[model samples]
Target: MDNPTAGIDRAAPVVARHELTIRAPATAVWGLLTDVPAWPSWQPDIVSARARTPLTPGATFHWRTAALDIASTVYAMEAPRLILWGGPAQGIVAVHQWTLTSSGPAATLVTTEESWDGAPVRADAANIRQALDDSLAQWLGHLKTAAEKPR
Candidate 1:
């Protein structure tokens, strides 16, 4: 859309971004980041997740995070680099994307962005924006923790 996101709604009511540098390679970070079904093990909010083997565009995945059941399609993806996915849930149409870039010999700069629209978001833009920001911030923190841990 208008923002840098791959497939987010161009005119979403709220958009949020959060990023951090992880002390690990992008490949290592990507491996932990993209495996949908394995999310619950590392992501505390992700109660459950399941997706087709080898994520690809148009492949839909179902996941529960923050007690919200979400089914998002793989709108776009690039191996070990970026993924964009989202769909309607609980009266909110949300789009989320993750980007990974190598920052140094063994470091990765991770960026996550998301957009939310629909009646609920439109009605409570400020609160929704903060929620989205907080959610992304938490997700990024988890990713960094998981990715940086010694494996």
Candidate 2:
């Protein structure tokens, strides 16, 4: 990792974390993950994504998922290794991070974690946690399929 990972809010009422080993190089997985506009193609949970501004620190991107429109700002980014982004949506504040570690010649140990805090999340912590867990799992599965695709 070129840069240290930025963590999610520890005090957040709801948190979800998931990790998976993908049979693809870190660079390959990072490529697919960072390409926001192409997210809907691989990550079915996302309805759309657009980043008119380059994905540097403080740059914001808008996307829709699970019927919620989210506008997330790129908080930190370390190419092929880590990225942290989040924002407020539907009265909930979310902080999400993705970390990719090269495990072998063509493998990556990828981890995704998110923290949520706000009235809605606190009101239904159990359901929100489960939903975030399911969403992250599906995201990892889809990334694995996309990155492992024959080039």
Candidate 3:
């Protein structure tokens, strides 16, 4: 079980990073993130989301994405802070973490981190990683726009 994320620096991993500083508070950003119905309005990749349990540490969720028709459980959740989860791809599991922090003056820094576990059977691990990375970038950009929009 080698570290899939090893040899990659914070500046950039083998997979790309999608980051944005939202001009809204963490709470506001979290609201947009956790809102199931609104996700499809902004996040083109996420087809749907439903809470299997209240947003507790061990609470669960069903996340469906258009990219892979994948549904993953919510492994971790903390409002105005973090959401972590993963889904299986050809027996290889992929994990992702979304973290939000207050930057200042009603601003929040949002970061998405992703990693894969197990060898990829497709032998296109790099391409797959890049696709995931690009998707995250699109997602984050959409979030930034949505968060900044007047409500």
Using TM-score, give the best candidate's number. Answer: 2
Q: If scored against the real structure, what TM-score would every candidate get?
A: 0.92, 0.95, 0.78
RMSD of each: 2.1, 3.4, 4.1
Residue 34 lDDT in model 3?
75
Model 2: residues >4 Å from true position, as ranges?
1-5
- Worst 10 contiguous positions by lDDT, candidate 2: 1-10
Error of 3 at 92 (Å): 3.6
What does candidate 1's lDDT look like per residue over 7-114, in tens digits? 667578899988899999999888987788999998998999998666788888899987799988888789889988888899998888889999987999999988
RMSD of 1: 2.1
User: lDDT for each of the candidates?
Assistant: 0.86, 0.90, 0.70
Poorest 10 consecutive residues by lDDT, candidate 3: 4-13
Candidate 3 lDDT over 4-89, as tens digits, reads: 22322232223456778999989988898777656888887788767755555444466667545555556667777987765565
TM-score of 2: 0.95
Clashes of each: 0, 0, 0
